[model samples]
Target chain A: MGRLTLPDADVIPFGSPGDPDRPGRGLGPSKAARLVGNTGPQPTSPPAAAAPTSRSATDADRPEHSTSHDVITDAEIPFDGESWLEFARRRLMGDYSVDDFGFDPELTDRVLLTLVRPLYRSWFRVETTGLENVPADSGALVVANHSGVIAMDSVMAQVALHDEHPAHRHLRMLGANLVFQTPFMGEVARKAGHTLACHPDAERLLAAGEIVGVWPEGFKGVGKPFGQRYKLQRFGRGGFVSAALRTGAPIIPTAIVGAEEIYPMIGNAKTVARILGLPYFPITPTFPWFGPLGMIPLPSKWLIHFGEPIRTDHFPEGAADDPMVVFNLTDQVREQIQQSLYRLLVKRPSAFG
Target chain B: MGRTVLVTGVSRYLGGRMAALLAADPQISTVIGVDVVAPDSPIAGTDFVRADIRNPVIAKVMGEASVDTVVHMGVIATPKQAGGRSTMKEINVIGTMQLLAACQRTPSVRSLVVKSTAAVYGSGPKDPAKFTEDMEPRHSPSSGWPKDSVEVETYVRGFARRRPDVSVTTLRFANFIGPRVETALTAYFSLPIVPTVLGFDPRLQFIHEDDGLEAIRTAVLSPRQGTFNVAGDGVLLLSQAIRRARRQTIAIPSLIFGTVGRTLSPTGLADFSSEAVRYLTYGRALDTRAMHRTLGFDPMWSTDEAFMSFVRRDSADGEVDVA
Candidate 1:
């Protein structure tokens, strides 16, 4: 090593240009070859040879073996695995802030969404419709029906928007307070671009030209019994409508089918939910019987249909403050999504088809 | 252009340095540096007065000097530094009470600048993302530097009410980190294996040492009348700060960390106080609108840059460079 000592060498191994945290594997041969070209005995390589000798001459007065080897190498040593190093690098270099809401895109892309993408693609076999309804590049609220014992439906919708849509827009999802209060889940949710389902967070995201997704029905939609599958619940107190009105974001009412069948909730374990400090402990058919294995969602064919955008810009100022306008808009959005669910159900042959 | 200024706590680095800066100004005729003990390094062009602020005789210093301005920079940061917990309280709380009392008595002292910390806004889960100067803390701090700061501010408020003519400026600063400032935060970051509260990556804001001194200088020169939240803009998460320092972090369960940290603090392994633990768990950020809009002063460094400056000077590789 002519000039490239431990202090001068950057410990963060350049993996890929756009995303350094994205692992670049099987590069030992090429990197070793480059090292040979730089430090080899052959002095004929003009460009590489000239670069080091000139710098080493400038460093001539500097003592040999001055750079602390044992101490420097110990701190600079990358861990064994690629992913751990990526995680450590992200954690160490302050590469965690992707959004003001503490969403780390690298973490979401490489870790969280990486785990969800397979489930959305192969396991659920989700086929999205009316992707054109999603605004190609601007801010729009995607209001979808929520279900499944877990919020796999919402996770899949996020994957759908990111992977399939023409613009590949990232959904700044509005999650429940429960999702943000729970220990590990809270961090994962925030890193995956999910903030509290509050108006301020929603309005800010929309104002910044972000696609925000909200399940207005909330736990009522997710924790509903199997008998009420495909039946829509109360669309909240119209908070999402108020947020859209405040920001003038067009509301794209989305309908997601087959999430209702993923883990069909047959009973409610209210006592257990209370003890565990959860909103609701859903008891499904295979849940109590098969244990952790039953938590695995069925390979239900998912149909996500995006309806036409409902314009809120035409409304005058203070429309968000007006309860009647907000109520009507909420009802209109709820009606559109309900109708889309009915139309999509007619086309589907079976839940698993 | 001739003005007499009294700078308190000249024994400390910030206080001693600020007094020297004040003295160097041609407009200022006199700079009197007051402290309990003589400063280790001399403050040029300033008369050093060895007198504790806790004593009643400090009132005589203000009265005799005919001081027009008072810069109170005598706040104790840690109990360990002040000899013990009770002594820390006496110096921080009683010292402020006496100083404010002396200012109240002296009619000529029209300008008062107090060095305060952002710990007045206690860290808790219910706290707002950014705390404005006027907003009350969600949970009022019960102990340590936070509680003392709150008590000091209360006394200052009382003083303001009594002497409405006086221009009172309180600079509630974020954690100070720079090339030379060895604050509690710096000490924590300097640890080989930094212990972090599990599942909480709290956001932290820092002001550079130069920025902090500049803020104090600005307060002295301009004589603003308001309690301002002075901090560098933007924020760095606790984990990110540790990472930037190139220090290894061990995620410790909060309960276990609490016991171990408390045990180790006395041994001088760490400067972990209950207030510090709360801060590490739920970090605080200040809304610097008052600093920018009202005070009309801009910090030289942002939050990230201030933290990086400290890291550049303190990291393992930089150790040799520092020497």
Candidate 2:
């Protein structure tokens, strides 16, 4: 039999705050309830009484949906379970949509991204800068150096763009054929919005106005020994360059530091890898000798820095067909990424700092 | 101009339906339905002719009737439907060759329409997201009806080049799903416990039976030269389709994935061969912009809508709704 009251912290974090200039418009049961005494559950509450003041304000006609939503947010602790149950029910009833590339946005955002967020945030403690270089909308190809033998670097960058960027753009990655050949990894990668590293797939994603990511270094960059770490590998015949040229999408050269220390490959068992039909059997300091537990990535300090976009629109038509232009562009992107990687290395205090 | 049209494979559902449809058209003076066996049910408008297209006798039928428009819809999809794999290949490859040879000889034929399956663009992991009409399959179909289709299209092209007067329209239709129609996919979905490849949810595209027939009708009415990919707009994920069907799914390991349809589903109907397994592993999509701009055919149902329509008829409750 008392007025509804809540602390500001109880408000939902999802919605932005309403106008402070508009009095009594915040759906504030907090300040008003304390002042109005225990004359409980009255139809004429303080907010209703002060409605006239709000009515005279600039946004009087605007609804207090945000205020109500904010209050509803975090109001009930068990709502997440209910909402998740609802999501499951919807999924069961086939009420979701997916892109032609088999990208399930709902599942990716709610499940896949949520699973990796902890690793990106606390475990790796990834620091990302220069994300503003990525366009808010429109197609842009992100060319990053591949590292972290397990491909954690790409996923970490994906998480960074989704969580940190202003646009929250989904980076549709161009993965190696090997990724799609594997069972669970292939399925998860597609759901996370990745396709084959072929030119057609890359061009198609770009044409659809999506931010596409490609690691040109591929296996060589990831499988190199710890001693050879941070040395740029051959950027795959400039296929990514031609794709950018054809789509007229800007190529963003990205540099990722700290991934090299994750596994620290000391040697490679070539024959065993070939027998197992794998690219290379990596022999990291703790791997194979320490068993599955060694699979755990070291908590290396991570820094993902996105550099300025290399414009492809300025080039004349048929530049993609010209090997000279493509090779130069590929080299330019490589140098930019390598330089930034060194810069980030100097900026960081230590490996696990 | 009431010109006579000859339709092949009239015993099959789609082929029979196509014949009846063409027969009903006032523009066509006569619709002759040719096949190896008698139609199961009586066709209303079409004049059934029990003649095998693989034989030179088909040329006689075309010549006597003075068939001007040839609608070849006889390419059987499943081995069971054709009795065996060899027979399916014989009918698809050899029958197509003979049919094209017959078409080339018949001077009256002016418009030739072939119903091709999108499976010709073989599915593989290293495939593009969407394949255009000109793009070749990354992994050429090693076996089954997909390879047969490749051969069929080739012969059709050869016939096209030999006779430039005829307007050759090849409509590459995606998997068909509807209440009345029966296909390998429908048979697979009808299994008691739907089995899927573990760790893979392939992208699926479907065309409603009505939309498919309408596409054929569109091409027949307004003949176009180049091949066009025909399917309802949008795509449905295999997992989404399973959920929509309200079926329990068992994920089989990829190692044992090849024989899933053969072992689980009824003995013969479902054709989950190597090419099909590859499709279930990594799905294929078609670029259908040309279907709209060049072919001038707009499907009434989107991909998911076509799938949901099938699901609606599949279950007794018929209560399919978005959550």
Candidate 3:
């Protein structure tokens, strides 16, 4: 596959290029023409000539094929913010309402929210100490440390948020490419509102003012070896901070206790993994080799805490560019979430204890 | 010179045949036949003893007979008759162990010959190749059939290891056909509306009753003490066998019969249905060259000859055969 590159110019032009004041106006025809000229138009002809027929041989019979260079790249595809919003609306028509996007407009979302309450009660054992901390209606990035080898904890967090909050927002999760490649699992993930965790995807969701969730540690956090349980894995040089900085969304540092014990990875068979085309052959107490009997996770009573939101509006523009500042800020946020989880772990007894 | 021999399960067809053959031999003075119930008419000059080998009385009986060799064939041959592993363990494993222990106690008993099954190999390539005594048993849980065979083999090996004085020989007998063959193969072929292959073939091996008895007689008489696979002189597919029998054989996918048999019959996972599927679909040909080389004996009848003899006998008996 070819490498994915960022667009030369931003797809959604929020304000005038090199200007701050002019916002919400669409890029004019001159800009559109320039963009088209730079990248060329989509191919309008087939690659092969049509077979000759006895019925008619007209001027259109000439072998016409567009060159590969004529096709526009993703970078040059013009994005109208209103058009995208309308597209998303149309795609979700009838099945979903505006209230479904975490608004208590007609109390329909409240009923749907009620439907998943039992699952929340059984799964997460969700206890909200600071219900006041969560804004009644705002796009907040709930940053939680991912546990469980396959981001099952992240799913439970989504389930918990949708169940507890009256608005019932379905948190859009940013997942890795591997998650989307698995057979039956990929479809289930898309239905659960999880998209590939790329800069463009994250930025687009954030720009749309949707509640986005991310695990900075990625697979490293989930697939921590048997020796390191509950200990956080390394979070790569702060891409999450940059996304938050660009969108000015509050980062709600969340801590989820008890997801670590669900499936304890006792051992791993590297040879089996290479043969099966899996990243790791986890020898958990139960798994892929066995049936439903293996799928059952050890019942660990869950406790999810939504910490006070850390506002990003105060930071000056381009604060993400300062390496030292970004590093220090990312470290501080990581330490805060880590310490909170450690404290929670100590406060509660074992899942069964 | 006369020798004394103890044969367990003498009431059964193969055991009875072995007992009668040994009794007829002038070298054998006395033959002790052990069973739960004594045979109505014992083999000529053979002593009938009522004793379950699973019980401790087996050692006492062997002690009284002072037999020179013990041929153990006292096992529930079919899984349905055996019930489950526990029941099979009581009869096959524990019973074999008890008989082995009895042989160990009797000072005169120098050899112990046990009847094992070729099904111990489970399902594999039917490449007409020989499987030596050392080939590991394929223990599969798809059905309890393979497990039962493996367990029996394991118990025998353990017993052999524990008793160094006794020379143990296990014979893995092939599918046998004779006058009284009542297995699924006989039942399937004897049916009025015989199900034959549409076009596909099946490789089968059958030992005649007399030849099977000769194999046991030779094993008991000879002082050799290793395992050997015993089968008929040659191999033939079911279609070929039916054709040789001069009977009309239809051709059909073996799976259809298996599905129908499983659905219609009460013996869903019995050895009969499983063996039928195994033979008709995935037939295996065993190499019995070692039996000829070591025992200096060859099966007198081929599968076709034995099966034809069976068909002739059935016809003469005027039995109503239904498929």
Candidate 4:
């Protein structure tokens, strides 16, 4: 299925790739122009030529290079002189601070996010909508439909919020136990500000005024057959709803489309899954047949839409404990995400386009 | 009208310093230091009583001294220090049982402060970011100091219930790190090249030696009822701490980290049990809000400040900062 219809602002704000600094500026052309003039080349790095010594060569060249770029960088790069060296020194000296969640703001903001930018921008071509629904400040639980065998959709959504939004807030993701059980990836996940998808961690992060993201669909949505692509799997016991209700954080149902096309899970090897202690052993179109090359997700055009927030604060004190209230809210969030998915699917031209 | 105090495990670092500090305090009338062996260095202004807490004689010591405050700091962290795992268990579990029994009998002992560990929370992938006072381990620990701490807490709770009038303060402290105290954590950091579990950067919290002692002193002077998590203001990622200490790390696999740590650091300064290995992988943090509010005790140094002080001073020399 494909669309020949013209792009609309109601579906998505703007073409994210067009604006380098501010990704989504379809709100207004005049406002975008005013912002570009005010912000300048600070948050993101300028073109290679504008700053001659933009790339760091070695520890020896750092001292001279740092002084030259001190004015341009001190605000964002944040160290007084020789930012790379100073950052390294500060890191080595253990001068840096991490939150109780082991979230390294410096590492996540500069390094981890930078690593994911290319995937979010060039590869996925992720375009987001209804960012205004996400509170600029304060806590909000982002309930999103999980898909894409590899789960690149979650990362893209995180990047979309951080890059596209006016406030540029980070989404503290609640991840599965597998993400944390695996080697190397676990540490990266924590440093990137992710924790185990547990009740306590979710409530704690929310109470601390963090934008918490949870994919209740989990592995069921991720490793499902390609035929059942857009169809949402069972949301986990509605734990996300309880966490939101407890913290009184409004639930923002986020819909991420085009991720299901990536990897295209044709079948699942149940025996292999059982042996390996994984949720499912995904047999994608390119995977196993193409070997390691198959791991590269299909360049599917991504569309993320944030729905209107469902207020949990209005509910009664013992609402979190009430199965009826939780079930109702969970269904509401699921329906909203499903509705947005259909809307986004209609707007996008094609999977690759 | 100063309170008479009885301190256990005065032979070790934390207990000896605690006894010395309690003896110096104007609020304490007499410091009766009880230990199986003599302290490594004599604790001034303390009446040293050669008493094994495992024996029933501790009750006699408590009765004779007319001790108003009982501070149990003898819970050993590492098995190597206590000769074996069984001995460590006996000292930690049975020793606490005997000590509590003695306190229960000695009517004069109105206040009890048991120094517990956050290890009772038990580190795992399933653990919460910060453990509150009431939270239990995700997996009930079956072995090591974590298990011992859990058992010790259970008995302390039982003691509180039995003796309704006695004000029992359970301070669940995070990892101890400072210039003077020599713990498994301190020894692990002091290594020429520390070995860490690969692919895991655990979140660790620390309470400086001075702050820990001060908290104990406060408990002794003005007793508080109920449990409290005693940690400094913040937490530290293990990797950052290693780097800050300027120690090279050889990361071993999670499975074999215990083995590598044992073989590499033959000095037995650090524990390499399954519980400790899990801790190395997923470190634990405590909610010390109750310590600040209920106990009215404020730590002078934060976790970061406390760790940095230890790294700065300890790495300079293997010797203790305080004489």
Top model number, TM-score: 4
Write candidate 2's Cα lDDT for A174-255 as tens digits: 9988888888898899989999998888998998878899999899888877766677778889999999999988888898
* Candidate 4 displacement at residue A96 in angstroms: 1.8
lDDT of 1: 0.77
For model 1, how big is the CA root-mean-square deviation?
16.1
Clashing pairs in 2: A12-A70
Per residue, candidate 1 scores C-alpha lDDT tens digits across A1-353 of 13223332222211222332433221122232232121211223322212111122222222111111121111122233345667765565665554456666666655676677667767887777665556645678999998887888989888777655434467889887667545567667766777778766788788887889999889988988877777777888999999999888888888898898899899999999999887789888899789999898888878787676788888999999999999999989988888777666655667777
Chain A fold similarity by TM-score, each prediction: 0.74, 0.77, 0.65, 0.78
- For candidate 4, lDDT tens digit of each residue in B94-115? 9999999999999998999989
Complex DockQ per candidate? 0.20, 0.72, 0.01, 0.66
Model 3 per-residue lDDT tens digits across residues A1-353: 23223232111211213222423111221232232221111133311222111111221222111011122221132232335456344333222222111122212222333344444455545443322334434555678887777677787677555433323446777776566444334434543555567555566666665668889888777766654665666677787777777777767677777677777787777799789887666778787557677777767756676655677767898986778767876776777677667555554455533
Clash pairs for candidate 1: A92-B243
Tell me the tens digit of each residue's lDDT in model 4 across A97-186: 888888887777667777877777778777776665666556788889888887788888887766555455678999987888788888
Q: Write the per-residue lDDT of candidate 1 for residues B1-323, one digit (tens) a residue.
A: 58899998888888898899999888788999998889997899899999989999889999998999999999888876778989989999999999998999998898999999999999865555567898888778889889999999999999999999999999999998898877777777776568888887777899999999899889988989999998888887777777667677888776677676655445453567777887887777777878998898999999889988888887545542322
TM-score of the A chain in candidate 1? 0.74
List the global CA lDDT of all models.
0.77, 0.80, 0.60, 0.80
lDDT of 3 by residue, B1-323 (tens): 58889998887767787888888888889999988766757666678888878878988887887888888878665655456657765777678777777777788877888777776765432221234556553323234444455676777787778777878888887777887756556766665445553433345677887787778878888856778888876555554456444454454454476665544345433233454455454344565767889867688887667877887777777763323
**Order of candidate numbers by lDDT, starting with the best:** 2, 4, 1, 3
Which candidate would rank higher by lDDT, 1 or 4?
Answer: 4
Candidate 3 scores a chain A TM-score of 0.65
Candidate 3 yields a Cα-based lDDT of 0.60
